[model samples]
Target: MAVQWVLVCHGLVTLLVVVSFLCGQWPIFQGTFIERIHFFLTSGAYDYFLRFVGAVFGSKCSNAVLSVEYYCCDRPNPILQIFYLGILSMTYYFIVKSSFAYIPGYYLSGIHRYTSLLAVAVGILLFLLTSFSDPGTINSANVSQYLSAYPYDNIIYAEKECSTCKIQKPARSKHCSICDRCVARFDHHCGWMNNCIGERNTRYFMAFLLWHFLLCLYGTVAIGLVLAGRLKELRVVYILTVYYGIENSFLGLAPHVAQWLLGSYNTLILIAVFLAIVGMLLAGFFGYHAKLCLTNTTTNETFKWQEYMSWQRKLNEAKASAAALRASISGMSSDRKPLLSKWRAFFQRSPLQDGQIVQNNVYDKGFVHNVVEVIYPLSSRPSFTRPKLKPT
Candidate 1:
C-alpha cells in the first residue's frame, strides 16, 4: 500500500509539469478560460512567443519581433496532443515499474532492477522529444515570420557556421556562451556535457535526459497522489465555505492537485504514458552504463580510447595496489607504460599469481586476494614435506 501510494503521487506531479510545459509550447487551451489567464500574464514581452506558438497551434494570439521556425510538432504525420502531454511516459513507468517492483526483492538493489530502469527510460525519451525537437523547424510559419516575431531571434544560432546544427536551430541549441560554438544537441549550459554533442555520448546524453526527467516525473506522480488523497478527505470548492464555516476561505491541506489533474481519461492516459516511458528509458540507460563499466569503456572513450594519455592512465590504474607497492619499493614507477608491459610483469614476478607467496609485503598481509581460488593456489603449491636425509 505504501509503495502504491508513492507511485500515485508521482503521477500527478508528472502530469502537471508536462501539461504546463506543453501548454507553454502549444497553448492548446487558447480561447478557453485558462488561455485567457495565460494571455494576460504573457502578453507583453512574451507576445511574439505567444503568437508563434499560437500560429503553430492555429489559435489566435498577438505577434512579436525576431523568430526562428523551431518547436514544430514535426513528428511523423499528425502529431497527437498525447505526445506533448506526456501521456506516453506516465503509463509505462507506473504500470510496468510497479509490477516489476512487487516481484520480491530487487535482484541487486532497490532501483537497479528492470522496474526502475523502465521508469527512467520513459523520462529520457520525453525530454529528448521536447529538448531535441525544434519548435521552429517543426512549425510551418516561415523563418522570416518567425524572425520578425521573435525579438531575441538573433541568438537562435548566433550566426553559427556549423553543418550539423539545425538550419533554423534545434530546440535547445544555444551558441555556447563560452565554446564560441553552437552546441548541436544542447540541453543547458550544464556545467557538464563532456565535449559538445559529437558521436560518442549523444546517446548517453539522451539517456541522461531520460533518467533525470523520469526522476522528476516520478516524484511529481508520487506527490500528486498523496495530495489528492488529502483533498478528497475534505470536500472542496462550493462546499469549502460550508465545510469550513468561513465566508470565503482557503488553505485546506486536502490536495489542490487532485482537482487540477484528476477524472479525465485523456489526462489519465497521458500521465500513464509519461510514467511507462520514463521507466523503460531508465532501465535501458542503466543497463548500458553497467555494460560499459564491466567492459571498462567510458563515455568519453566510447568506441575506442584513441589518446595515449588515456591508455597510460588506465594501465597505471589497473595494476593492483600490490603491484604499485612492489614497483615503488623496487624504484620502478610503472607510470606512462603500455598495458601489455605491466600485464606480463604481474604473472612473472608476483608470488600471489604463481601460488608460492600467499600474502606478504607485496600487499598488506591481511589483504584478501584470490579469495575464491585461494585453496587452489595453496594446494597446488610445492608441498612442505620433510626432506629425506642423504646417507653420505
Candidate 2:
C-alpha cells in the first residue's frame, strides 16, 4: 500500500510540473497557482539564481554568468540541441538495459527490437531535417521574391524594410535576434532544434513533433505488453488462486496483482508513466501547431492578432463611451429617468457588443491551400522567382 502511494505521488508530481511548465501561461490557468509555478519555472527561478550568484560571488562572477546565459539562451547556441539528443539517447539506453530481454517473451515479437531502433532513427532524422533546414531566410537576393509572395494585411503586417538586413521585409517575416537573420513566415525559435521554424522547415518541425509523439506512445505500449507477457508466462494468476487461495474475481485479485507488479517492475512502470506523460504533451503540442498550420498562422502571428484585437476593442469602447456621454449631456432634463430593474439590467446585452473586434486573418487561405503552403513554401515555387511587382 505504501509503495502504491509513493508511485501515485510521483506520477502526480510529474504531471503537475509538466502541465505547469507547458501550459501555465494559458488563458484558463491565468491568475492561478499553476501560472505562478509556470513563471517560477520559466523565468523567476533563473532570475533569483542570478541575483544569488551576484550577492555571493560579486559583480565579476555575475557578469560571467550573465554572459553564459546570453550565449546559451539569447544567442543561437546548440546547448538545448545537445540536451535534446542527450535525453533521447539516455532514455533509449535505459529502456534497452532494463527491458530488452523480454522483447520476444510471450506477447511481443523479436521484430520489435529492430522496429524500435528504426523508429528512433527516423525520429532523429526528422529532428535533423528540422534543425539544419533553411527556415526561409530573407536576404537581399531573394527579398523581392518573398515580398511578392506574401502581401501585407495592413493590420498586423505592413510593407517595411529590415533595418539590420537592409532588405525589404515580407509580410509575416520577422528578424530573429538570436539567429541575426530575417525569416519569412516566422513561427518561433525552437531551442531544442537550435533553429527557427519558418516557411521552409515548418513541415519538418511538424513531422518531428508527430513522430516523437508516436514514438513515445509505441515505447509505452510495447513495455506494457512485455510486462503482461511476464505475468502470463509466470502464471501469477494461477499461483494466486491455487497456492494463495485468492478469489478468481478481478476485484478480489486486482490489488494483489498490482502489488506484485509494483514490487517486481517498478522501474518499467516509472518509464511507462514518463513516456505516457511526454506523449500526451507532444500530442497536444502537435495539435496546436497543426491548427496553426491549417489556419496559415504562425506563433508570432497569434500574439500579433491578440494585440491587434485588444487595441481595436479598446478603440471601439472609447468611441462608444464618448458618443454616449455627449448624448446624455445633450438630453439632460429636470425629470429623473426611470431606473432599470436589477434583473433586467443584469441580463441586458451592451449596445456596443456588436462592435466587438474579431481576428481577421487575411492570410488564411482555405484549409487545403494553407496546408499545402506549409508543405510547399511559396519561396520554393518557380512562380515566386523573379516576381513582377504589380498594383494591389
Find the candidate with the highest lDDT and give its number: 2
| Residue 94 accuracy (lDDT) in model 1 | 62
Candidate 1 lDDT over 208-273, as tens digits, reads 554665564664455344334434444455465566554553455234323333432224434445
The lDDT of model 2 is 0.92
- Residues 30-107, candidate 2: write the lDDT tens digits: 999999999999999999998999999999999999899889889988888899899899989888988898888898
TM-score of each: 0.23, 0.94
Q: Which ranges in model 1 have alpha carbons more than 4 Å from their true place?
A: 1-17, 27-101, 104-174, 178-201, 206-392
Worst 10 residues of 1 by lDDT: 356-365
Taking all chains together, the TM-score of candidate 2 against the true structure is: 0.94
Count clashing residue pairs in model 1.
71
